[model samples]
Target: MEYIILVITFTLFIIIAKDLAHHKKKNPVLK
Candidate 1:
């Protein structure tokens, strides 16, 4: 069960990271 939760959390983290990266790319001011 804990492993499943960990995997879910990791995927969520990756999704969030990708979203943030996309946002940064869209708005150069963030850099």
Candidate 2:
């Protein structure tokens, strides 16, 4: 159960990071 939770957390982190990156790219003014 612990391992599964860790995996889920990692996946969410990666997804959020990717989304932020995409948003920044879409709006260069963000940087």
Candidate 3:
């Protein structure tokens, strides 16, 4: 159960990071 939770959180982090990166690319002000 603990391992499953860890995997879920890791996947969420990756998705969020990708979104942030996409936003940064769209808006140069973030840089």
Q: Backbone clashes per model, in order?
A: 0, 0, 0
> Can you write out model 2's per-residue Cα lDDT over 1-31, one digit (the tens) per residue?
6999999999999999999999999999987
How far in Å is the alpha carbon of 2 misplaced in model 3?
0.3
Tens-place lDDT digits, model 1, residues 1-31? 6999999999999999999999999998986
Clash pairs, model 3 backbone: none
State candidate 3's TM-score.
0.87
Off by over 4 Å in 3: none
Best-first order by TM-score: 3, 1, 2
What does each candidate score in C-alpha RMSD? 1.0, 1.0, 1.0
TM-score of 1: 0.86
User: Which ten-residue region of model 3 has the weakest summed lDDT?
Assistant: 22-31
2 against 3, candidate with superior TM-score:
3
| 1 against 2, candidate with superior TM-score | 1
The worst-scoring run of ten residues by lDDT in candidate 1 lies at 22-31
Compared with the true structure, what per-residue lDDT tens digits does model 3 show for residues 1-31?
6999999999999999999999999998987
User: TM-score for all predictions?
Assistant: 0.86, 0.83, 0.87
